[model samples]
Target: MTNDLLGRHRAVLPDWLALYYEEPLELTHGEGRHVWDAQGNRYLDFFGGILTTMTAHALPEVTKAVSEQAGRIIHSSTLYLNRPMVELAERIAQLSGIPDARVFFTTSGTEANDTALLLATAYRRSNTILAMRNSYHGRSFSAVGITGNSGWSPTSLSPLQTLYVHGGVRTRGPFASLSDEAYIAACVEDLRDLLGHTRAPAALIAEPVQGVGGFTAPPDGLYAAFREVLHERGILWIADEVQTGWGRTGEHFWGWQAHGRNGPPDIMTFAKGIGNGMSIGGVVARSEIMNCLDSNSISTFGGTQITMAAGLANLNYLLEHDLQGNARRVGGLLIERLRAVAAQVPAVREVRGRGLMIGIEITKPGTDEADPRTAAAVLEAAREGGLLIGKGGGHNTSSLRVAPPLSLNVAEAEEGAAILENALRSVR
Candidate 1:
């Protein structure tokens, strides 16, 4: 049955859409942190559908909200006044930390970021964009243009001239050997030098933690330092928080807050996890920047009623349960446990991330070169042991991505870790 489905999927779907496992399991249902395949084999879900299931699988609150809203109306478009959309927008605006903030909804992180590019270029009247090295923003043409990871970006043709910046990844770079303080200074100096050689760019867009380039991040205040230089040059700073927003990083509600000394960004784009599993994405900016577009615009399916309702419910549940704090406490423990497990495995190069978003980089034993084959072996072994994780990185997807739902408990974390440890050992 799985083989038949795989054949049909390959026939109908784009080749670029990658699936996991040698024989991918058809997940038919989920409950809490567990999901069951079509063959009724259950596994502990650590990837959370690429971290989109922020709260939990089959969350009752989100399900109820969606069903109730659907019974009344699923979508009324952005043409009519959407109460749910307005409510969700208001809540997000207050939490956004942008003064006099306005929110415009989209359906995916790609769309939100594309809208952000539109705003920044129009506001600053420049087509040049500064993007971080080894960062993954989205898959759209404009988003791909800004993306620095060569493996993920399929094209060089772009409307905007994008210049890749340094300091997104602290390890495996020219400045990797430097101390944290020295590294920040070197990156700042590099930014200043780049600015001198190029036309005034509209904005410097970056992820606080590079998601698809692996869960790598700069020092806490690196962005703050860069913000000072960009601010002086009238270059807007846009934080792409698609993977780092909504308290996923235990210590900060938003990833940019790790650099809070710099104040809020000129604009912020978000998408994944906001609606739990529902499609919800948007851009938040000060009214001045958001209103810069004189021409009228509307997203046909951006702020539809159903997705907004889901967002509202999910956000409420996340806040009410204090999932951020949970992520901090639980994620900290999970990382430590995984670190202990990784220490025993020679192929495990490094384990890095904050809160629930963690990455284990697999490498050749006692060497720095990435070992993607080992990573793939571990992924398959974990699945066979009833654990589901993810793999990503710029180095041919050599990192195991262990981002569970924010509601992950200690027992589940320990269980998942044990399975992962066994998988690593088996692979070795």
Candidate 2:
């Protein structure tokens, strides 16, 4: 049955739409942090559908909201005043920390980032964009242009001229060995030099944690340092919070807060987790930036009633349950366990990240060279051990990604860690 479905999927879906594992398991249903495959096998879900199933699978509030809203009306184009949409927008606006914030909804993070680019370029009257090295924004044309990861970026032709910057990854770079303050200074100096060589950029777009880039991040306060430079140059800061928003990092509600010494970003984009699997994305910016366009613009299908309802319910549940606190507590234990186990595994190069967004980088036993084959083997082993995790990195996708729902508990964290430890050892 799985083979037949695989054949059908390949025949219909794009070739680039990759699947996990050599024998892709068909996940039919899920509840909380666990999912059941078509074969009735239950696995502890750590990846959370690339960190999209934020709160949990089959969360009651989100499920009920989606069901109730669907019965009333699934979609009412942005033409009319959507109560759910308006309410959700108000909540997000207040949460965003951007003064006089206005929200515009899109169906995915790609669209949200695209909308942000449009606003920034129009407002600054510049087509140049500054993006971090090893960053992955989205798959759309504009988002692709700003994406600095070669594996994810398929084309170079773009409407906006993008200049890749440094300091996103902290472990493997020219400044990797420097102290945190020194690294920040070096990157800032590099940015100042880069700015001298290029046209004034409209914005510097970045992910607080590089999701597809193996969950890599620079020292805290790195972006704040960059923000000072960009601000002086009149370049806007756009924080891509698709994966890092809503306290997934455990430390802050938004990723940018890790670098918020200067303040919040000029424009902030978000999507995954807000709707707990429902399609919902949005951008928040100051009124001056959001309302810069002279002509009209509207997302015909954005902010649909049902998606907004789901988002509101999900957000409420996340807040009321204090999932951020849960992530911090559970994630701390998980990472510590993984690190202890990794110390005994030669193939495990590093274990890094905050909150629920953890990554284990696989590499050769005695060198810095990435061993993607070992990473893949560990991933396959984890699945065999009844655990579902994800993999990503700049060096041929060699890092194991473990981002469970924000509501992950200490018991589940320990369970997942044990399985992952065995998987890592098996690969070595």
Candidate 3:
């Protein structure tokens, strides 16, 4: 059955739409932290559909809200007052930390970021943009234009004049050997130099933690320093929080808070966890930037009743249960355990990230060269051992990404870590 379905999928889907494993497992159903493949094989879900499952699988509150909202009205084109949309927007705006915030909903992170680009360009009257090295915004044409990772970015054509900045990844770069303070200084200097060569950019868009760049992050306060420079030039700061938002990073409610010295970003884009499994994405900005558009615009399916209902319920459950605290506690232990395991493995180049968004970079034994084969082998082995993880990196996709549900408990953390350890050993 799985083989037949795979054939059908290959025939129908674009070849560029990649799937996990050599033989991809068809996940049919899920419960809290666990999912069953089409053939009845159960695996502990650590990736959570690329970290989209925020609370847990089949969370009752979100499920109830979605079901109830669907029963009444699933969608109404953004022509009328949407109570759920308004409520969710109010909550997100208040939580966004931007003064006089306005929220615009989209169907995906790509759309959210595209909207942000539109706002920034229109407001600032420039198509020039600054994005960090090893950063990924989204997959849309506009979003892809700003992406800096060569592996994920398939084209050089872009609507925006994008300047790739330094300091998104701190592990392997010209300034990787520097201390945190020196690295930040070097990046700031680099940004200053880059700005000298180009027209003033409309905005500098960055992910607080570079999600597709193997969960890599600049040192704390790096962005704050850059923000100082950008602010001086009246350039906007946009944080792409698609994967790092909603307390996944633990210490901060928003990933940008790690660089909070300059207050919130001028604009923020989010998706992939806000509505749990529901498709909900949005952009938040001060009204000055958000209201820059002079013409009428609406995302037909954005802020629909069902998705907003799920988002509201999911956000409520996340805050009520303090999932951020859970992410901190459990993810702290999990990273420690994985670090211990990695210390014994030469292929494990580095273990990094905050909270549940951890990454294990795979390299050739005793060398810094990325080992994508070993990473792929470990992924396959882990799946065989009843664990599901993800892989991403700027260097040939050689990093193991471990982002469990924020509600992950200690026992599951331990279990996943043990399985990952065995998988690493098998690959070695």
Estimated TM-score per prediction?
Answer: 0.99, 0.99, 0.99
Cα lDDT listed for each candidate: 0.94, 0.94, 0.95
Look at candidate 3 and give me any clashing residue pairs.
Answer: none
Off by over 4 Å in 1: none
- Point out where model 2 deviates above 4 Å: none
Give the alpha carbon lDDT tens digit for every residue of 1-428 in model 3: 99999999999999999999999999999999999999999999999999999789999899999889989999997999999999999999999999999999999999999999999999999999999989898898888889998998899899999999999999888999999999999999999999999998999999999999899999999999999999999999999999999999999999999999989999999999998988999999999999999999877999999999999999999999999999999999999999999999999999999999999999999998999999999999999999999999999999999999999999999999999999999877
Tens digits of per-residue lDDT, candidate 2, 1-428, equal: 99999999999999999899899989999999999999999999998888899999999888888989889998879888899999999999999999999999999999999999999999999999999999999999999989988999899889999998989999888999999999999999999999999999999999999999999999999999999999899999999999999999999999999999999999999999998888899999999999999997667789999999999999999999999999899999999999999999999999999999999999999899989999999999999999999999999999999999998888899999999989988877
Worst 10 residues of 3 by lDDT: 135-144
lDDT of 1 by residue, 343-412 (tens): 9999998999999999999999999898998999999999999999998888888999988999999999
* Location of the lowest summed lDDT over 10 successive residues in candidate 1: 16-25
Scanning candidate 2 in windows of ten residues, the lowest lDDT window is 295-304
How many clashing pairs in candidate 1?
A: 0
User: Cα deviation in Å at residue 320, candidate 3?
Assistant: 0.4
